[model samples]
Target: MSYRSWCLALGLCLINGPLLAIERAWPITEGMDVVGELSHAEAAYEDTLIDVARRHQVGFEAIRRANPEVNTWIPGEGTRILLPHKFILPDARRQDIVVNLPEMRLYYFPRDESRVMSYPVSIGRMDWGTPVGTLDVIEKRENPSWTPPDSVRKAYAERGEELPRVVPPGPDNPMGDYAIRLSRPSYLIHGTNWSTGIGMRSTHGCIRMDNDDIGELYSRVSLGTSVNIVNQPIKVGWRKGLLYLEAHPPLEELEDDAKGMDEAVAKVMDAVGERDARVDWSRVRSALNEVSGVPQVVGWEADQPLTTSTSATSSARAEPPAADP
Candidate 1:
C-alpha cells in the first residue's frame, strides 16, 4: 500500500504530531490484553531503514528484524515492508519501564497516564551484554558529559585513537543531550548522537535510544521509576481469548545450544500460564522455528474457527506469513 493509505488505515497522520512522539497507548480494560496492530508501508526510492522506522514510530532493529531480506542501506522503491507494531506485553507487572533485550524494545508504563509508550533501543554487544534484572532510575541528567570507562578507553586506544578522560557534552559526546542512569553500575538509558545504532547491538552495555526518543523519555520518567531488564526471546499472551505467540531470534550466545532453546520455549509456556486456552503444537512449532519477532496466533477458543481471520476478530491481531520470521 502507498504510505498515505497505510497511515490512513492505521489512523496515523504524518503531519500533525511530533514525529518522535508516537503514542501507542492501549487502555487496560478487562478481558483485553494486547496493544497496537500489524501494519505495512511501501519503500520509496530515497528510503533507508532508519527513515522508514522513524516515520512509522518503530525502532531500527525492529524494522530490520521484520525485513531481514531487505537491504538496510537502500531498499529499492516498491519494496513492501512489514511493520512489527503489534506486541505482547512482557511477563511482568506493567507498572514501570520494561526493556526486553532479545526484542530490543523498551516499554514505559506511566502510573498516572494509564498508558504504555514503547521505543526501540540499541543494547550492548554480546561481549558486553546489558544486565537482566530489576533496577531503578537513580539519576537523570541533561547535556550529560561522558566519562569513558577504562575498558572502553583501552579498546579505543588499541585502535590508535588517543583517549580522553572525559568527553564534554557536545556533538562529539555519544550521550547526546540526555541520560538516565540506572541503579546498575555504569549502565544508563541515554541518547546517541548517531541515529544509525539506535536499534542494534552496538552499545557498551548501556541502553541507547534515538536522541528524540531519549529526550522525551528523560523528561517524563522520574528519578525513581522502576526499570526491569529482561532477556525473554519468546512471549505468549492472550487478546480476547485468542492466544498469540511472539518470538525473537535467540541471542547469538544462546542460539546454538539445544538446552537454551528448550529453556526459552519453557519460559514462553510458563508465561502463557493458566489462561483458559489450548495450544496448537503445530503453530507453536512454526512460531518457534521462525523466530520472527512478530506475534502469531497459535491458539484460540475451541469454538472459534481455527481458520478464521484474526484481523476480522480483533483490529490488532497479528496473523501468519506476513511478519519476517
Candidate 2:
C-alpha cells in the first residue's frame, strides 16, 4: 500500500499543524495495544548515529542500542540502522498524560481523540529523582525562565563558576522555549536547550523534552490535563494476535522496580489471558536484557493467522535533524 493509503487505513497521519514535531498521533485500534511501526534507515556517507536518531526523532541511546553493531560516530555510508520507534503501551491506565520514567518517554492521550502522541524525554538524575504519581498541569509558560536551585547553583559554584539565581529566558537558559508546570513543586515538563539529553537520566527532578516536540505539545495540552508518572521498564502487549515485548533500561536509581526478564515473563503470562501462546523464552530473555527499546515478538498462538511485521525501511537525511541542539 502507498503511504497515503496506509495512513488512511491506520489513522496514523501527520497532522497539518507541524511539519517536524517528534511526536506523532498514533492511532489506538480496537484490541491492538501496540502503536507505531518499526523501521530501518540507511545511513548516508556523512551520517552518524546521532544524525540518524535526530532525523528520525528518536533518542541517541535508542538508535545506538538498536544498531549495536554499527559505529556510533561513523556508521559509514549505506549502513542499515534499525529504528526502534515501535512501542508496547505500558500496562498502566491510559489517561491524559503518562510519563514512564524508566522508558524516558511520555504519552499524551488527547481528550476525545482516538490517538496518542509519544515523545522521548529526559528524567531526573540519581540525586534529584522524578517522583511517581498523578499530578496536574498547573500552569503553562512560554519562554520560561530558569531558576537554578541552591543545589544546582552550588554544584556550579563547586566547578568554580558563578551561576545566577534566576537566569532570564533566552538562548543561554537551559530551559528552552516552553514549559508546562506540574503540581509537584519545582517539577515541570519542559523543553531543553540541549536535545541530546532526551532519553537520558540527567535532569533536576523535571521532565525535559526536545524543543520542537515541546513546541508542538505545549500548545495542544491544557492546564488541567491529568499527568500520571509511572516507572514501567518492561512492557508486554499484543497486536494482531501476536505478543510482543518492549524493554527499556530501568533508571539506575530504581533498579528494584522490576526484576528484569522474570518480570517480563510474568507480564506476558498474565497478558496471555485465555490465549495459548508458544512463548519464546530465549527471545524474551535477550530482549529484556538488551533493553534496546525495540519490540520483539515473544509469543504467538499457533492457531492464529499469519500476520505481517510492520518493520519497514527508508533512508535518513545526512543533514541535521529537525530539532535545535
Candidate 3:
C-alpha cells in the first residue's frame, strides 16, 4: 500500500482503541517539508493528558500546548483533545538524530532510508539546560548503570534522602534499560523509569525517553551517528505549496532574552528559503500569540486565500494535502 493509504488506515485504528508501543515512520518525499496528519482522540472517563499522549506517540507538553484549555491532570470524559501529530520538520540537517528542545521531540533519519521516526523527549530543566550543538553518539549500552552526580546527590541529601554512588540496572534505576551517550560530557539520550517526565522540562541535564522508545532507537542507531540539538520554538515549512507554521512555548530562560523572537523568525525565514510566497502576517501573529503546537496555514503563493476547516470546538481536525501518486 501507498504511504498515504497506510497513514489513513493507521489513523482509523488509532482512534478505535489503544496502540502498541511502535514508532510511527513517514516516507521522505523529495522537497517535502512536513509529514503526518493532525488527529484527535476522545477522552475516556479515566483518561488524562499523559495517558492520551503516550497512546498517541506524542509528548505531554505538545498535547497540552495544543489544547491549552484542557485540564492536564483530569480532563473529564468526552473532552475533545488535540493530538499534535502534525509537524513541520525542524530546521536542521535531516540526518541521524535531531532533537528540538522547544518542541520536546526527537527525529531520526536513518541513512539511505526514505523515512523519519519521531518520539517525545524530556529535556533538562531551566537551570541545567541541555546544550545546543552538533555531536556524535560515542557509546551505546543496555541495562546501563546510573551513578548520581555530586550535585544530584547533594540535593537528595538536603532532602534527607541518601543516594547510592552507583545504581544497578533494575526497577529503581532512573536510566532505564538503554542509553546512548553523546560526545558532550555527562549527557546521554536514555530511557527513564518515571515515564511521566517524558514530555516536560523536568530532567537534570540529559535527554529522557520512554523505555520502549529508547529501546527501538537504540536498536536502529549505531555509534558515531550525528546528533544535532537545536532550540527552535517557531517552525515554518511548506506542504503542497502551502506554508505552515507551528509554534511552541519558548523556554523559560530564553523568554526574556531580547534576541529570542528575532532569531526565531530569522530561522523560519531561512527554512522557507527561495520559495516565492506571501505570508499572512495576521495569521502569523495569531499563531505566535497562541503558541499552539498544531500546524496552521500562515501563507500561500497561489490565488486562493488560505482558509482552514478547523474550529474552536475541534482543533485537531486536519486537512492533510493529497499524497503524491
lDDT tens digits, residue span 39-91, model 2: 78787776667667777788766777788899976687899999777888877
What candidate 2 gets wrong by more than 4 Å, as runs, is 1-23, 306-325
Select the stronger candidate by TM-score from 1 and 2: 2
Q: How good is model 2 by TM-score? A: 0.85
Q: lDDT of candidate 1?
A: 0.77
Best by lDDT: 3
Candidate 1 lDDT over 126-184, as tens digits, reads: 98889889999999999999999999999889999977999999999999999999998
RMSD (Cα, Å) for all candidates, in order, is: 7.8, 12.0, 10.0
Pairs that collide in candidate 3 are none
What's each prediction's clash count? 1, 0, 0
* Candidate 1 segments whose C-alpha is farther than 4 A from its true place: 1-21, 254-276, 305-307, 310-325
lDDT per model vs. reference: 0.77, 0.78, 0.79
Off by more than 4 A, model 3: 1-23, 256-274, 303-325
lDDT of 3 by residue, 42-123 (tens): 8877666667777777787888888899987567899998888888999888999999999999999999998999999999
